[model samples]
Each structure stands twice: as structure tokens, then as C-alpha cells.
Target chain A: MTGVTISGVGITPFESDAERSALELATAASEDALDDAACSLEAVDSVHVGNVLTEALDVQGGLANAFVSAVGLEGVRADRIENTSASGASATHRGVEAVASGASDVAVVVGVEKMSDADTSTVTDAISKLTHGREYVQGITLPSFGGLAAGAYLDRYDAPREALAEVAVKNHENAVDNDIAQFQKEVSVEDALDSPVVADPLRLYDCCPMTDGAAAVVLERESDAEGVHVRSIGSATGTHAVAERPDPIEIESVSRASERTFADANLSRNDVDVACIHDAFTVLELLELEEIGFFERGTAWEATMRGETARDGAFPVNPGGGLKARGHPLGATGLSQVVELVWQLRGDLRGDRQVAGAETGFAVNVAGFGNNSVCTLLEAP
Target chain B: MTRGTRDADGLRVDEAFRCGDCENEWYYTRNRCPDCQSATFSTYRLREGELVAYTTVNVTPPDVRSANVLGLAAFGDVRLIAQMSDDDPEVGDSVRFAGQYELREGGEKRARLTGVDGDG
Candidate 1:
């Protein structure tokens, strides 16, 4: 709805307990973004906050209000948007609209989460409540969906588990240079296979960790620098209960949203120079790539097997390690994708991690089990 | 079929609810038909299903102690996540609608359109 350009982006380390509080992390990120844009905090017209599991994990609520006060964007319209893991992108979508629709001249959108407060088991169970209550809440964890989907994909394609392993290895290798990445160490296929199994066919390396981090983006109707413009953004919802999907293996929301976003931008998938897809699970990397039409059905994994998605491969994907290696702090992940793309488009990243001559980039953020998804296409001016 | 949440004897497993207006059928219990949003419905019991996909979750959180074996089984018009009784479930297995079995031996059982109960 809104024609917005992102002029500044800020991100914190994915693993640290630094800043101590969600609001503090968010304020710091916002400050960095404003400073990056050479704009004062008072210039922000509105504030949008994205977060999930905050009360359960961070012991806080009304985060948008807290952030506005911290940033001196007081009395401006503020809203907290949540769509599970897609919260960040959803909030970005709202901020973009707020500015584009003449509602706000400049909107400060931030996605922050502090997930380290709770233990792993408690945090895992807390997220289970967001899944299909009829089944998933009982026995199947989110990684179980990855395992089941991996089994189905391998069976459908007659492929081995190596394709999934390749995603973990490649993303980890990419993360090695990402200063803000949680895991700096690269992983190997053997390491992934030999790691303890969380779900059959998916090992420790195949899963993204629960991280604590914050990411911020400054959006305005226009930009002065080599800003990345929001070409198009599309959002859609699939079946909340994944088991009830007509095609259990396909993420229809990602497919539909990606198509709409590209169509909105009047661009085709071939125009994309880079992408940041949600890889919360290793199997997700393949499934999302296939559903989003980057690679044909049953072939994305094959491409990965050949290093097609590596930083130096045919089409670079998740050069900043993705959620798998970058560490997904729930809400921070989606906006973080946009940040990585902004850096790539501006050629701000280092040589090895950057996509060469990247003029356009694509980012996709997915909610629980693909229940909902938001896709954004970004282009450099 | 009824809501499958109760751990006790679940509703009939073989029987599935179909919308009277739109002829849409779904496995899970719902107040309104998802297709036409019609509340009127009829029930049909299917004998068996074709196992589509399955996985075993070995490492889980504290709440889940045992390895979780779950699968998607298609019974005519709809597919549902069912707890697999077999340790190694194969896709396309000719699984009968064995209904929901309680985890405890001789525990009260409710039959929902889940999947085949293991040797129990």
C-alpha cells in the first residue's frame, strides 16, 4: 500500500544476553538505525514493534509503548504486530504501509526478542502452543514437522539426506564471516549426520537455535543515499493445522505470497539476484525454495547438492547463514533477512559473503509451519 | 466425529464428517464445513487409509519423553496426523482405521480418524 524506501538498518549479535532487556535491545537497535540514516529519533513519525513469546520469555508486554518512549517517538501511532515467527516482516509490512498510505512520513520498525531467559525445554514447549492444537501440541514438535517433511521430500524425489545436510553445511560456512551470527564455526556434512538426532533424519545442525537478538529498519517515503526500495510485499495464510493441508509437503502460503510480491513489483523470479528464505529447519530450506518457484518442485535439494545455493553458486541464498546459522531470535529473524539483503544490495558486506553486482534481492518470512507467510522484493536505487 | 482433544475414548475413527451443502469432507471435527461454511453435515466411516508420510522424533523436550512417531494418512477426501503404532511406518502402507489407542495398556480408548493402532 505504501511506497517506502529503507535507508538504514541495525542488528545486534544473535547469541548475546547483552543489553539485558528486550526494550533495551530494541532501543539500541533503533538508535543505531536512526544514526545510520543521519536522522534524529524525533524525526520518526510512528513506531511498530514485532515480537513473540515476550511475556512468557521476556516477562514484558506493551513493548511498542515502551520502545516509543525510549526512542522519543512518543504520542505517535504505535502498534505491535505478531504472526509467530513472521512477526518481523509483518511489522515491516505495516510500517511500509503506514508511510506509503500517507499515514506516517517515517516509521521506525523493530523486531526484538529475548529468548535466553527460559530454558530450552520450556521455550520449546511454549512455542508448541502456537501450532495446531488438535495434534501438534501433543507429541509433534516443530522439528518433527521438518523430519516428516524431509522424509516425504526425500521419498518424493528419491534423494538422500545429503541435500538437507548441504544446507546446514553451506549456511554454517556462510555464517563464519557474519560478525553478528550466533555460530561462527562452519559445520560439515559428516558433523550434521553424526550429531544427535532431534528428529529422525534431522540432526542438531539441521535445526536453528533459540537466540536473543534485535533488528531495526528505518523506512521513509523517499531516500537520499543508495537506498533499497520496497518493490513489493505480499502476505498470505495457509492452513493453521498443517496436518489438514491438501498437500502436506507444500507451503502454499509461501508460494502464493511470493507470487503476489513478484507480480506487485512487476518482476519475475529470474530478476532476483539474492534471497533470504526462512530456514528454521534444514528441510525448510529445500521446501521453501521449491514452493517459492526459485527451483522447480523436487529440484531445489538437487541444486543444493551441487552447491547451487552456496554464496558462490548459481544463485546465492542466505549468504548471512540464514536462520540455521544466523540464529533465529523468533521476531528478529524476518527483519534480519531484510537487513542482510540491504547490505548485499549496497555491497556493504565483505567480498566472499556478498552476491556480486546484486541490484535486486528477495526475502521471505514464514510463520508457524507455514500457517502464514510474508514475502518482500527489494531493489537497489 | 467429535473433537479429538479428549484423551479418553475419542470419537469414531472410521467415520468422517461431510458437509451436507457443499459435499466437502474433513477429518478433524469442526462446527462448520470449511468449504461452504455450512453447519449441516453427515458422517461416513472409512475402513482404512493409505499412509502418506511419517517420522520418528527421538530427541524431544521434557514434556515428550517417548520417541514420537507421527504420520499423515489419507482416507479418501482428507488427510490427518495420526500417532503411528508401528516403529517403522512405511509410506503407502495399507493401514486400517485402527482408531486411537491409549498409551497405557488396557487404558480407555477413543476412536478418532487418527490411524492404525499398533499390535496393541
Candidate 2:
């Protein structure tokens, strides 16, 4: 079992830059990553990009190659990897494997998505296709499914509504110093609580915004790398559709992936210094925390409300503000998590948002109601 | 629609192919007994089971406004996803089929299941 090392990482500012196309953003991020690693396009052997609905968004086919060529990486093996919203992590996993297996000395992974240009309903309709098409024909959107899961969580665990609100407040506070985040201003708890409801038990603020952004990471085998070590990588899949699951909050796939990664790294939950669990929805963070074994079942809300997961709390979770405040460009989200982890591990982050003494970190990417999941463990060099 | 035979419990039961020698019965859909690799099978309407998993569709098809609850039920080792009639169902709750219900206007149909009597 050879180890893979992440030599460098990069990200585009997650904001409404309607003037620039998705490929332009991707090129910028890719160049940043390559430059940070002190490597050039000639040194890279493969390129992996993640974009959820590039075709649906009227982007040309072979978009990955198009972006790579624009970034002056033509003649390199390039391909797109999509797995619902978790496309970024899926692509990263592919790139890591390429390096670890000696198929390539260096591989670059990029995630980009432009979601704000499309109509909300159209975006919702497109995302719904990730579920059972027959089910989507019934008009089930992500928000609807999220609401159902939130309701179940609230009912079964007696999860407090206020605790969920706390998640938004904490993330927003952390985002205040994140210049690249979509929402840089903090909001009061009352503002979060009073926001319009998108789905029952979930307000507008509780959900991540429809953001447009890109993120990239450069990976090289440990023997050829000059950076942080990829201690372990694990992925798992569960029921295909959310309706097929026994409990939405259980997230069996995520739990399995986390357990496998921990075992592979020969570390326990207590060893993780920081974590970035997918917070597509605020409640998702709570469920992920519990499912990842950070806290006991039915206690994530309590842990959150008690400030256990705050930026300066006992265990800093989502110091990058997570998808909730940092903005969620579906394709870029998983890669964005990796970028934050790399920066934290390297002590490169500026301002008040840095996680103190962070050495080992974990990132969990859940796709389509935990149907597909990937977990990665990172350690400082 | 052809009316299926009803069992002693008054639940509708449809006949399906079953290996006479294997004595294996399956209800919804299958070409053969997956267990023994026998191309033979029999059908019996599911009588009793428990909800294995469930989720509600808040944004339903154009025809429906209220959330539609759905779940998978297990009768012995056989499991299938079906429309749930109960408002809130917990995993392991007993369930019984309530016959077929119209799922869509274009002849789409599905059998409905509810919590067992006195088990709700």
C-alpha cells in the first residue's frame, strides 16, 4: 500500500463572477495549484476534472480536455469524473490512485461548476436527476429530500431546532475571515431563525447557496513528492436512492468510509485535529458528525449547541465555514474541502479562521443522501 | 383489471411462477428463484412484514401536493419498496399490504402498504 502525497492545492474565489466562464475559473485554479507545487504542466501526467452538469449547462462535450488545453496542459491524459455532487472528491480519488499506482508521477485534480447562471427551478430539476429518474419524474428535488431527512432527524432524535440554527451561526462566524467565501458577513441567530423556509424544518440560511467556483489539487507519490502525506483514503456506497434507506440520518456509507479510512491510517477519531464534513445542509453536518463517529448518535445537535464544533471550540469543525457559508459549487465542494485541509495542515491560512495546532485532518464527501461517500485522512509532512 | 384471488386474511394474492420442486415463492417481479438458480418460482401476496427504511417526497409530482411517504418492507428475506400509507413509520414497524393504488394518471400504479392493525 503505497502512500500518495498532495503537493499543492488552489481555489477560485467563491463569488458571483458571472463574467467568467467555468473553464476560465478552472484554469486559474489549476495554474495556482501547479505553481504552488513548483511543478509545470510538462511535469503532470494526467488531469481529472469534476463537473456535475456541464452538458446540461450548455457547456461543450469534452469540457475537461477543453479546460486543460486552455490551461496549456494539452497532450496530457484528461478526463471528467462526475458522481452527483460529490464529483470533486471522486475525481480527487481517481487522481490519487493514478499517483499511488505509479501510472503517473504526478496528477492534477480540478473541480469547477457554474450554478448561478441557470434558473433555480432548472438547476433543481437537473440535480433531481441524480435520484431515481422515475422518482424525479415525481418532482422530488434536493430540498424536498433534505426536508424529509431533517424531519426524520428531528422526530427520532428530538433534535432541537435551535441547535440547527446554531450550526448556521457558527459557520457564518467562521466565514467572516474567509475572503474567498461567498458569504463573508456574519448573521445573527435571529436572522438565521427568521429566514424564509425552503423546506419544512430548513430555512434558506440553513442551506448552502448556489455558488459558482473552482478548486484544484496536485498529487504526487510519496517517493516523488515534496509535501504533505495522504495518510489514507476510503470510499463506500449504500442504497441508490434516499427512499430506499432505512434511516436517512444513519448514513451507513459515510460511516463505513470513515471507519475504513481511520483503520487504514491506524488512527482513531480522537486523533483527528480538525474535520470538514460536507455541510450541504446544516443538518447534514450534524448527521455527518454523528455518522463519522465524532459523537454518539442523537448527540451531534447537543455537541454543536454546546459549542464543541465551533472554530475555537474543543474540536474545530468546518473552519473554512463549510458549504453552508463558504458557498457550495457542487463540483468544487469536495476539492474545496481538501484545499482548506491542506492550508490548515500547512499553517498557510490567514486571519482568525485558522485551526490551532492542526496536524491530522479528515474530510467527508457525501453524494446524494449518502448514497456514495468518500473519506480522506491527511497528515502534516 | 383482473381481480386476483384473496387469501384467508382477505389480502389480495396474485399467482407467480414458482419452482414446484424448489417451493420458493416471490411476489413482485422475478424470472427465476435467485437462491437456487432454478427457473421455477411461485407468487404469494406479501401478508406481513416490517418497514426496513423510509423517506418522504415533499416536492411530489404535479398531481400531488402533500408529501408522499415511501418505504421498503421485508417479509422474511424478500424486500421491496412500496408506497407507505402511514404518516410516520419507524424502522421495524409491522406492515400489511392495502392493495394497489393509482400512482400516476398514465396507468402507472403501485400497491399501498400500511402499518399492521393495532401496530400503528
Candidate 3:
């Protein structure tokens, strides 16, 4: 099988709100990625758009076709991939598969979401529907899941409430240097803990804000491209209902996906130099780290409190601020993680945020409450 | 395990399903058993269960109450998520199904759990 390489990656400034349409943001990011690759639009054989809310929130459809038209690309195979919040990574995986299978020599993967135009309640209600139909009727929002999990984690492990706050503190601190991050300011643990309660035990700072943005990556069939190799991608599905899982705090999907990713790449967790995890909620960073084998169960909070996952720590995670601070534009988040990994592996970032001597990187993007997950491994060129 | 044969009320969230083949119990509605893929299944009412986790949802949907409490309760081997009548409930606390109520505007009437006496 032919290997695939990320020739270029680009992203729009993740903002709490954006004035542009999803299609416009997607086109701009795709153009930037194409330019970064030094490849013309004509060289692109396929376009994969990762998006979820445009139709529901923006009242727009046919985003892929519209993006291709906006970019003046003709007759290229266009497809839209939507896996809820994991849509971006799913699109990246799809584009890489196209290039790896020789179905397309050059593929563009873009993830975009426009959420600011909608009402706050509308956005929350729409996101709430991502859960099982039965659970949706119970009015369980995503933050409720975080709050429940945080409560359970704290009680079960006897972890300090400050441990959860530490995640936001570290990620926000890292975002201070990320120019495209939505919140480019450090938040102290006190600030996080004092934030208004969105759900019991989970203050506002623990949750990712609704964001609008786009990110794109160019995948090329193996060549002399000076880019990071798309080593492999693994995906898995868990119980649809969060309550159905035997252990509410255990994200089996992430564990299974990471297991498959490592096994397929013939590597171990120790091989990962840096990681961009799906920290949609502050507690998620710790839970996912443990699930991905970076830390032991119930000990992730202890490790997090010790700053082991900080940018300068032994197992650096989310140096680009992750979803908590970098902004979670739903579909764009997964691709944004890959974009950060590409930059890290290329050593193109500034000294402050760079993961030094990074040769391998891993990223995991999860759907609602770990209903599904997609994990990718990237190796330096 | 037949698909789409149940009446509207038959699909209520309060009902739990048991696989005849593997004897596995689940809360969600599915045609086949997740464990054994058996089409033979029976439905039972979720009357009482132990709370595995609970949260007071301060931020609810527009139609729901502001400080809605929710919990994941286990009925035998089946687990279901429902709104809690108790303001605060701890893990391992006994909770019984209170009744059905609309948790959201235009939403279905879902089951609600309340902590047993002095258990919350």
C-alpha cells in the first residue's frame, strides 16, 4: 500500500464567533493549504469536507460542492464526512485513504463549522441531540455528561476538585502562545474553579465554547514531499447511550481506537513524542489520557495536577491549547488537532509552544460522550 | 427483536430489554441483542435502581428547568439515564422511578428517578 503524507495544513483563527460563512472559511483554508503545499488547485483530485452544523445551524447545504466551486476546482471528486464532533478527523482519514489507495494523487481535507449565527439555546439544543434519542428526551446536554463524569471521577478516585481545574489552567496557559487560539490568555486554577457553574461540579471554564472556524490539510500520495507521514488511523464505536456503558467514566471507544492505531503502526505509547487530545471538557483531557494508556486509570488527575501533561512535561499534551482553549468548531476540531501535530512534527512552531525534537505525534478526536472516536498517528518526515 | 413493531408507548424510556439467548439486559431500544445478536427479547419496567452517578444540570435546554438534576441508574443489569427528582443524590444511592414527565418542550415523557428515603 502507498503511504500518504500531509503536504500542507492551514486553519482560520478559531473565534467565539466569525462573520464568514462555513463555505467561505472552508475555501480560504483550503486555498491556504494548497498554497502551503506549493500545489495548484488543478492538482487536487478529491475534496473531503468535514462539517456537521452548516445545514442545521447555518441553513446551508452542499458545502463540498460549494467549496469546490468557490475554489474554482473543476470535476474533482467531492465528499462530505460527518461524524458529529469527530467529523474533521474522519475527513482527514478519508482523504488519506484516498491518496494511500491511489484513488487520488492529491486530496484536500477541510473541516468547517459556523455556529455563531444561531441562538445560544439553539446551539445547545442541537448539540444535545447528538446523544441517543432516549437520552436526548431526558435533556442531558454534553456538559451534564462532563459534570456527571467529573463528579464520579472525583468521588471514585478521591481526586481533588482542583485537579480538574488544573487541566484548564494548563491548556489555557499553552494557548497564550497559539496565535489562532480563541482564548490566547492564561487562566489560573482559581479562575477555572470560580467560573460560573454550567453543570454541577463543572464550571463554565471546564467546557469548550461554541466556536466558528475551519481547518484544512493537503494529503499527497507518497513522493519526495517534505511532510509528515500519515502513519495510520484507527476508529471505533461505543455504546450509543452514555448510560448504557457499564462504566460511565470509561471511554472504551478511545481505548479501542488507540489500541488499533498503535498496533497498526507497530509502535507503542512510548513512541509518541507529543499528543493533541480531544479535551472538549477539562476533565476529558485526564480521562482520555488514561484511556489512551498515557497514564493509569484514576491516576490521570494526579498526573495532571503534577503538570506531567504540560507542554514542558514528560508526556506533553495539547500544546496547541486543545479544544478547551483553542476553540472547538465541532467539525474543524479533529482536523485542527492534525494541523497542530503537523506543525509540531515539522518544528515550525515558535520556541515557547514547540515540542522539541518531536518525531512522532498522536491525536484522538471523539464524538459526543465517546460514542465514537478516531485516532491518528503521524511520523516526522 | 422485530423492528418497528412497537406502539408509541411501547418504546418508552422506562422499559428495559432482556435478551432471551444470552440473558443480557439493556436499556436502549434495539432490534437485536448487543451481546448475542438474538432476536428474542422481553421488555420490563424500570421500577427501582441504584444511582451510578448524578449531576445537577445548571445549564439545561431552553425548555427545561434551570436546575435539573440527572442521573444514571442501574436497574438490575440495565442502565438508563433519567432526570432525578432529588436535588442531590450520591453514587450507590437507591432510587426508584418516580413517574413520567416531559423534560423538554415538545419532547417525550421520560422516566424520572427519586432517591429512596434519606438516601440522596
Candidate 4:
């Protein structure tokens, strides 16, 4: 199979700015990407945008085209890809496939979400719908879902509650060096421990905040590219409903996707120079590390607290601050990870948090808890 | 189990047949009946399973309870999600179906599963 290469990528600093619409944010990110690639909108062949709750946000339809038109790429063929929180990565995957299959010489992918415009309850309700419709009607929101997984992980592994706080502190400390991070200020483990509880075993600090942002990437065939090569891309799905899962900590989708990606790239976890796994919640990062075969079962939290995933540690995870601090704008998060990976692989990161000598990178994007997952591998050519 | 039959609501229902010819239990939503595959089947009350997982839906759907609990049980090799009985359920609890409940103002009718009498 032909390889796909990412020529350039860009992301907006996550913040609460009601003045800018979702399309505007998307266009800005796309412009940055096109600038980095030394190309104009007229040079692009196709566009793929990722969005969630655009209809709920009263955007009606034509959101994908709206992004293209706003970016002055009116003649480009465009479509939208929505897979809940993983929408961004899913859209990136589609754009990659388009380039790999020779469907388009240059494909542009953008992921944007404007959730702050919606009321808190409405946004929570819309996000909750990502779960089983029937199950969500009962009272299961994302926090509670994470809480359940936390409870199970705590009981099964006897993991200390303090370990979760440590995860938060590590990510926040890493974010301190990230200028664009939403929560760049460092927080102590004590601060995390003292924070009010949103759900049992999950404090306010343990969860990612609601964010609005955009990320974009420019992809081309390997023969046509000038930067990092997309070594492999793998995606898989699991039971949509949390109640249907056999074990919340052992998400089959992530495990399968990571395995497929590694196999396709002919690499293992040991071959990876750096990684950025989804960390929507603290426990999620731990579980994902184990699921992606980084740490053994029941040892992720322990490894994390021991500084295993620290920026300067042996295996740095989420060097871009993760969703915990980098901001999880839902639809934009997956592509944002890609942007960070590109910077790391190119040795262009201008911060104290850059991963040193990151030659090969892996990223995992998970949607709706453990329902839908995708893993992509990239190597500097 | 019979292959084609419509329920009162016009929803298609099928029965799983066990042996070609024998008195066996027919199952709904199964590939084959446990007792007789005579291809003949009938719907019967399915009971016996522990709630392996559950989630309470905060979002209300029609007339359903605002905090309705959804439970998943592993009966034999098949695992399915079912509505919880009257009592609140936790993960790894046991539950059984009682009877059908009225649908919320324009929602599909559902059966209620109650906590069983044994310790889970």
C-alpha cells in the first residue's frame, strides 16, 4: 500500500472566545497549515472537516463546505466526518486514505468544535448521547462513566487515589511550558487532592475541561510530500454502550487498533520514540497505556506516579500536555495530537516540554469512553 | 424456534429451535434453539443472570425514569443489556425480568427486571 505523508499541521489555542465562530476558527487553523506547507487553498484537491453538535449548535447543515468556503477553498470537494470525540482523527484518517489511494494529490483535514455557545446542560446532554441512547437516558454522563472505570480500576488493582492526583500534577507541570495550553499554570498534587469531587474518586482536577478549538493538517502521498511519513494508520470500534462492555479498563478497540497499527508499521511499543495517548481523564491515560501495550495490566498508574510518563522520563506520553491541560475541544483533539507529533518529529517545538530526539511517534485517539478508537504511527523520513 | 412471527407492535420476532424434533425451550434473538431445532419455536420467559455491568442514564427519554438503570447480564455465553428491576443495582449484581412496563409517551414498550432473591 502507498504511504501517506503529512506536509504540515496547525492548531488554534483553546480558549473561551464567543466572538469567533467554529468556521472561523477552522479557517484560521487551515490557513496556518497551508502557510506551513507553502501552499495555497487553490493547490488543495479536497477537504475533510470534523465536527460534533454543529446541528445542536444551530449551524443547520453544510458545515464542511462552510469551512471550505470560509477558508476560500470554494472549488474543493469537501465533506464532514463525525465520530463523536474521535471525529478529528477519523477525519484525518479519511484524508490520509484519500492521499494514499491516489484520490487526491493534496487533501486538507480540519477539526473544529464550538461548544461554549451551547448551555452547560445542553452540551453535557449532547456529549452524553455518544453513549448508548437507552443507557444515557438513565443518568450516565462522561464523569460518571469515568468514575465507574475508576472504581473498577481502583478495586481491581488496589491503585491509590493519590496516584490519580499525581497524573494530574504531571500533566499540568508539562503544560506549564506550553504557551498555547488552556491550563498552563502548574498545580500541585495537593491542589488536585483538595479539589471538589465531580464524581466518586474523580475530583474536578481529574477531568478535562470543556473546550472550544480547531486543528488542521495537510496530507499528501509519500512521493509528493516533504516531511514526516505516515507509517501506518489503524482504527477499530467496540460496543457503543458502556453497559455492553465486558471490562471498562480493558477496552478492546484500543488494544486492537494499537496492535494493527504496530503490525502495519512493522514496529512495536519498544520501537516508538514518543507517544501521545488519549487522556480525557486521568484514569483514561492509565488504562490506555495498558490497553496500547505500553504498561502491563494494573501497573500504569504506578508507573505514571514513578515518573515513567514524565516529559524527561523513559517513556514520555502526552508531551503536548494531553487533553488534561492542552484542552479537549472534542472534535479537534485528535488532529491536535497529530499537530503536536509533527512538531516533535520535525524538532520544531519551541518549549521546555519538547520530547528530545523523537524519531518515531505514535498517537491514540479514543471516542465515547472505549467505544471507538484509532491509532496512527509516524516516522521522520 | 419459528423463523418469522410479528409481535403485537408489528415488530418482527423469531424463535431459536434446538433439536430437529424434541420438547425444547425456544429463544428469542438466537440463531438456534437449545432443545429442538425442529425449526419450531415459541417465546418463553428468560430468567437467570447476574448484572455484570450497569449505567444510570441522566438524560430522560419520554416517560422513562430520569435515573433509569440499565444492566448487562451474562446468561450462559450470551451477554445482553436489560432494564433493571425495581431495586437499584450495582455492578456484579443479580437480576431477573418481572413483566412489561408501559412505554413512555410514544416510546417502545420495555420489560422491568428486578433484583433476584440470592446474594450476588
Q: Give the true-contact fraction for every prediction, in order.
A: 0.58, 0.07, 0.79, 0.08
For residues A267-310, what per-residue lDDT tens digits would candidate 1 score against the true structure?
A: 99899989999999988989999999999999998899898899
TM-score of each: 0.93, 0.83, 0.96, 0.84
lDDT of 4 by residue, A1-381 (tens): 238888988888887554688888898899999888887777899999988888867764889877777777767779999988899999988998888888889999999988897877778867766655444433457776776677679878988899898888988888887777888888998999898776556788989988889999999877776978899898999866664465656788999999998998888899888888888889899999999989999999999988989998989998888999988888899998899889889998765667888999999998988789989999976
Please give the distance, in angstroms, between residue B24's alpha carbon in candidate 2 and its true position after superposition.
Answer: 10
TM-score pick, better of 2 and 3: 3
* lDDT scores of the candidates, listed in order: 0.83, 0.79, 0.88, 0.77
Q: Model 3: which residue pairs collide?
A: none
Q: What is the lDDT of residue A30 in candidate 2?
A: 92
Worst 10 residues of 4 chain A by lDDT: A131-140
Task: Please give the TM-score of chain B in predicted model 4.
Answer: 0.56
Choose the strongest candidate by TM-score.
3
Candidate 2 lDDT, A267-349, residue by residue in tens = 99999999998998888998899999999998989989889999789989999889998989989999999999999999997
The C-alpha stretches of model 1 lying farther than 4 A from their native spots are: A16-19, A223-226, B1-15, B42-46, B97-120
Candidate 2 wrong stretches, greater than 4 Å: B1-120
Q: RMSD in angstroms, candidate 4?
A: 5.4
Most accurate candidate by lDDT:
3
Candidate 2 is graded, for docking, as incorrect
Q: Rank the candidates by lDDT, best first.
A: 3, 1, 2, 4
Candidate 3 lDDT at A346 equals 92
lDDT by residue for model 3 (A1-381), tens: 238899999999999879888888998898889988998888999999999887777578888888899989999999899999999999998998898888999999999998896999998978887776667667889999998889889998999889989999999999999999999999988898899998879999999988999999999976746688988998999888888787878999999999999998998999999999999998898889999998889998988888888999988999999999999999999999999999999999988789988999999999999999999999998
> In every candidate, how many clashes are there?
5, 7, 0, 24
- Candidate 3 steric clashes: 0
Query: What order do candidates take by DockQ, descending?
Result: 3, 1, 4, 2
DockQ of each candidate's interface versus the true one?
0.49, 0.13, 0.60, 0.14
- Give the Å shift of residue A378 in candidate 4: 1.0
